[model samples]
Target: MTVIGIAADFDPPHRGHAYLLDRARDLGDEVVVFLNADYTAHHTPPLLPYRLRREIVLELGADEVIPVRGYHQRFPLAYTVPVRVRLMAEEGVDVILDAGPSRNLDRLREHVERVLEVSDLFSIPPNVPARNVVRWLAAVEYVNRELGTDVELLLIPELEGYSGRKIRAALRRSGYSPDSLRKVRRHLPRETFKKLERYLKARTPPIARRKELLDVLNRASSYELCSIAHLNTIAVREILRGRPFRSERQVWGALRRADYGSVLTRLALANTECRVTSDEIARIALSWCVERLVPENQSPDSMYRRDWFVAALSSHGVKARDADRLYKRADSYEEARRLARRRYGVDPGVPRFETLIGEARVSDGEYRPAISANGRLGVVEDGFQELRATAFGATLLRYVLDDPFVDAVIRVEDEEARLIVFPGDSP
Candidate 1:
């Protein structure tokens, strides 16, 4: 099988790159592209990272992408023609394709069946959309003049101006939204847009995670970790600044000093090797809250920023925790219970503290004087003491109600009464 060789940076393959590959594929059995390695510097405009660029090239339909690692470093004195020729020979390639103008066609001819050169069709000045024709003609002439190789220079003009410069410039100027970029990308063919999106994602400056953090702050509650949310947001933003947000404590201190914007901006600018996943962040948020905000014995009443509570629990892959945090303090019990069930698999039948309060009494004496036939406080000693006792009673009621075998009996009849029934139905 004849192996066709293509030289490419393939930084998120664009339409022009795809055109060359497609044209070459028709003339060969297998096509192999020499990819720029992570360290190679390609003067291609709006370049993406090497790994991402290679992936895009693959997506664009390259049969194989051979990493051209150390090529530039090792062949610093040689032009692209010699280096590529050496690389192709190693791969046992027969035919060769160059997207750029071939500078050394005669030399290349010695190593391959044919050397084809393709140009960026879209980059031609719109006024003279076929400007590449001049370049193509010149390339052919160069071969005829320099090497006496009358080699054919194929001209594939990209009509839409899909150059990296154009794409980047357009993206910066609001000529396109990200969503619009994705939609219009379809017009460029699969491989082309894959390269484009890859380049954009790789080279685009990281946005601060602070905005997301602040958004988190809008909903955090006390029972969750307030400091952790602030820290996570800061840490993510710090990554953008080329600095890692090392610890929750550091984030907390920075937040205490109201240095939020500075750290956030830093993290927003720095890019991580891995983008933060929602599940990962959710887990982080949950841990932060569970450890910081919602400590074992703390009441939910003192909390602020309810969103943080919800986000933390949800972020931690604990959908149940998130639902509980969101609904636990709801004004309506049914609403709270319903949300708990739907989001977290919490059964509404679980006994509440309220159920216990109504069924238990602190003392028999306290329960006795209250029952007047007319529903009046029949010579009660002190209403304040009674109120305090009742509050205590309510808490105990809920604790016991949680027991599966305990059936609480709370009654207010004739005047007032309450009781607790156990497994045997005895009160």
Candidate 2:
């Protein structure tokens, strides 16, 4: 039995999606779709929830629908694409069906080969259109070579006149009203329109996790923010510069002024919402490398020097080839830094202690109260006391106040009251 596989967001499964599924059915006996999770690859929540999107796709004619998890949402395509291609290979998919700008298969293959040869998908030239197409093609080739799989690429011309962005914008503008559905009726399949209308009337669409995102943006320390995936020192400073953002738009404006592109801005917001730390991404990458590359009996320690792990290390501004070289030569992280500095005459943008605080802390207690950054009731002092807290201390205090099980510890030292907070279960 031949199985055709496709990976997509299918945010609202329109006529374009249905057409692709029809083509898949024509070519193969079974069609499997790997749908993006609650968050899309672009780092935003779907207009509809994952459950609704999955149901829509299944209704549209998918034999099996698998959900890609949060790990894909945390990093750039350079890191996640290989993992996705590996998934398709492991599923026994014979043909990977996708739509690209060009219909020339030989040209696409050549482009993919060139990218893999350089080992740097991040440095694709700006003049090249459809970089994602190149990235996917490269991923399929890389995974096929590594896993010894025979997954063939099937490229179809991109269907025109159905823009998911325009449909979503209309829905939002009309508040998901029935009239809005009617306006975009031509773009959606009959089944998709009916399902979406019924779903929208019965329940409101799920919104982005803006409150959680703002909570992290307004409260998280610079050091804590730096630990999030896709966030560098400059990005963290941009977020900090726009203090106490009232909404996501304000944060977007700040990032835009700092020359952050749409993709990076969305990634920042998504990372903040999920609180995805760099450490977490590294662990996920290491596990993926071990699973796909390492021998079953071999130690996992050797997995760190592999390609995927090198890609993960490249997140901190190191080039992929350079990271691979440094990984083999340097015994420790500090040694790697030293080598990079010597070779490049500059640090590879690693997060350092000095970057944590761009400004000095002031000791004036009256100016900086003991309250949390969100202005919630953090501390109550019965007697006279002066309170001064560091950014890290305030962040911890905010977390402590938010946790229901933790109790705040208050101490009185000679006429000054100090707040000592720790996270623990209630006695």
Clash number by candidate, in order: 42, 0
Cα shift from native, residue 14, model 2 (Å) = 0.3
lDDT of 2 by residue, 259-329 (tens): 78998888777877888754555455546555553222111233322322343345445576676677556
Q: Estimate each model's TM-score.
A: 0.32, 0.69
For model 2, the local distance difference test gives: 0.64
Report lDDT (Cα) of residue 223, candidate 2.
Answer: 45
Number of clashing residue pairs, candidate 1: 42
Q: Per-residue lDDT for 1-427 in model 1, tens only?
A: 8777776555446677777788778877887888766423222122345666666666666788888764332111112333344456567776666554344544434322211221111122335423333333333443344433433444333435556545544555553344546544644666555555554554452221234333332333211111121223323223223223444334444444434453332222221112222223333323433433112111121121122233333434555344544544464445655665676664444323122223222334332212122211221333311222243343333222222122233443332334333321223
Q: Which stretches of candidate 2 lie over 4 Å from their true place?
A: 291-427
Cα lDDT, model 1, residue 232 = 35
C-alpha lDDT values of all predictions:
0.40, 0.64
